[model samples]
Target: VSHEFKTPINAIEGYTMLLQGEELSPDQEEYVEKILFNTQRLSGLVGNILLLSKLENQNIPMKKTEYRLDEQIRQAFLSLETKWTEKEIGFQVELEEVKYTANEGLFMHIWINLLDNAIKFSPSKGTITMFLKQEQDSVKFILEDEGPGIEDDVKSRIFDKFYQVDGSHKAEGNGLGLALVKRIVDSAGGTIKAENREYGGCRFVIELPKQKDEII
Candidate 1:
């Protein structure tokens, strides 16, 4: 199914890019832009679906390497700087230096998805906080966002595949993000959970075991 869809999707995306380069009236350009956006969104959805399938089948292998956890988080935040800035959201980061051994790419997805979600749900000009610390034998990572807290019922299934909370349907996601995050964390011998913060908003807590003996 993925192969079948890829051909036409790629064709549409190619044509859209070509059309965007052509001279057109403002109205025509707007329509073409919309077309391009939806096509790109569809492509992303397809990619996520294919990736989740590979993950579920155990077809993807972890490429573990030594890396500084704090640096990884900082880089992820920096990469999404435009998104948060556009939304006028502020950040409070308190990351402690910690060495970790894991698949750098997969771990990056965790930070990106969580940060993206926080930004998406947060009200404009709201603040998001990220706290990272090294616990006894594991790394504690917490991300909190100034958005509506998750309901009790939705909290349990938030990590389930294709499970979007009631109010998140309008968000630009097909609900695969958290599911992918959970899978990656599980593969790395980590535990993750979400809860409503007392002060408002939601918090995601992840604890990944540290490989103290691994040399970077």
Candidate 2:
């Protein structure tokens, strides 16, 4: 995971710096800066994946607690503030003060992956809306992005391992993030899904049971 994630960032950074050094006009420099900024975003995503892999692979136990869902959502946004700013995207939160039980470290990855996807597909100067609601048996986490929505043909298989949307703006993902997210949520006896919203763009909705259940 580390190698897969870091390789692209390293390449982007190297080329971006090299490009930035050339005696270019203001417009060209702006273009290069966008490249640098995206590379940095990719770096952060890789970092999150590495952290998640370590947490999952290590035998060490995690501190499971009932944490505020809103805070995690905010933390995910806070961590990606730079990426959003660079893309000129706005994030709107409609969070319910709900709590869920999980290892904060592992649970953090879920939000990171979701938010990262949002930032990637969102249009410049677009809005990404997050909805967190508490249901009778679970808490619902929804993220909506304003980019080109996924096609219906790919929607059903999107959560499958190694599955990726093939089109323009489909960021280079190993297809592992969503698969890993499914695994983590399944272990917690939760459910997750992805679909194109009716209005437009892609939406990821996760429903995690508040009560603890042994992972099947």
Candidate 3:
């Protein structure tokens, strides 16, 4: 199914890219830009669906290794600079130097999805803060975003498959990101939770056990 849909989607995206390079009226350009955006979104959705399916079937193998946690987070944030910059979002990073043994590729999905959500729901010019603290035997990773906090009713199922707070299908995501994140974290023996901040917005906290021997 993924291959079948992605074939045509890729063709559409290619054509859109070509169209974008051509000269057009302001209205025509606007329409083309929307098409380009939706096409790229569809491609992403297809890829996520394929990945989640593999994860559910346990077909993806885990390659756990010791890696610098702070560096990983920094790389993820840098990768999404374009997204946050486009929305005028500011970031406050307070990452402590730490190392952990985990599946680096799978672990990256957690940071990417959480950071993506922070930027997605946050209002323009809002602030997102990330703090990494080393506990006695675990690491506490906290991400706070200045967005509309989750409702009491939806908090329980926020990580469930295909569960989107905005059920109108207007949002960019197909709702599999958080589900994937939860699964990956669980596989790594980590705990993740979401909470509404007292002051405003929402916070996602993840605690992962630290390995005794740290690999440089």
Candidate 4:
């Protein structure tokens, strides 16, 4: 499997470097750039695959600690600033200062992936609202975007592995982001849900039990 993976990546890097150094016409450069971009994406996909493999084999370890929830979210936004900036999407943050216990790295991945999806589906120049509230027994985290809303038929199966929305989107994804998000949240003793916003676009709500209880 390692040989199977490394071969293509080595080939791509060799070809990409050749294309970059060689003198090519403007049109050819554009085409080569696309190839390079996609090659990078493939590299990232390979990394994700290796990570998933380690996770499946239970080789990954968890390090949990107590931290402020809103601060974690702010860090997520800062890390993902490029994605939002490129799309020119505005964000509405309504997070209150609250502390929670969890593996920060895992939750960072969860937020970036979820927020990236929200920003992708959101319309250009549209607003994405993030709400954090304390409920009776848990904390509610809501991320709502202003993109084309999810169809009723697909909503139920959205979290299923490799289940992309059929026919409407041709976007490049292995459809693993949400699935990973769901799994991580579940393992953390939290719940995640997605729905079409009443006004427009898609909304993802995650409920996490407060760390004070610790019983999960």
Best by TM-score: 1
TM-score of each: 0.94, 0.70, 0.90, 0.84
RMSD of each: 1.6, 5.5, 2.0, 3.2
| Per-residue lDDT of candidate 3, residues 29-94 (tens digit) | 999999999999899889888888888898888877888889999999999999999999998999
lDDT, residue 37, model 3: 90
What tens digits encode model 4's per-residue C-alpha lDDT throughout 34-90? 888777767756766665566567677878887888888899899889988988999
Model 1, C-alpha of 164: deviation from truth (Å): 0.9
**All models: lDDT?**
0.89, 0.79, 0.90, 0.81
Candidate 3, run of 10 with poorest lDDT:
207-216
Question: lDDT tens string, model 2, 75-147?
Answer: 8889999989999998788998876667887777788877878888788999999999877677789889998
Best by lDDT: 3
Query: What would the per-residue lDDT of candidate 1 be over residues 1-216, giving only the tens digit for each residue?
Result: 975787899899999899988989999999999988988888877877887888789888777788898999999999999999999999899998887888898899899999999998999999999999977777899999989989898888999988898744645788889999999899888999999999999999999887769543
Better of 2 and 3 by TM-score: 3
Which ranges of candidate 3 are over 4 A from the true structure? Answer: none
Query: Deviation in angstroms for 128 in model 4?
Result: 0.3
Identify the superior model by TM-score, candidate 1 or candidate 3.
1
- Candidate 3: residue 202 Cα off by (Å): 0.7
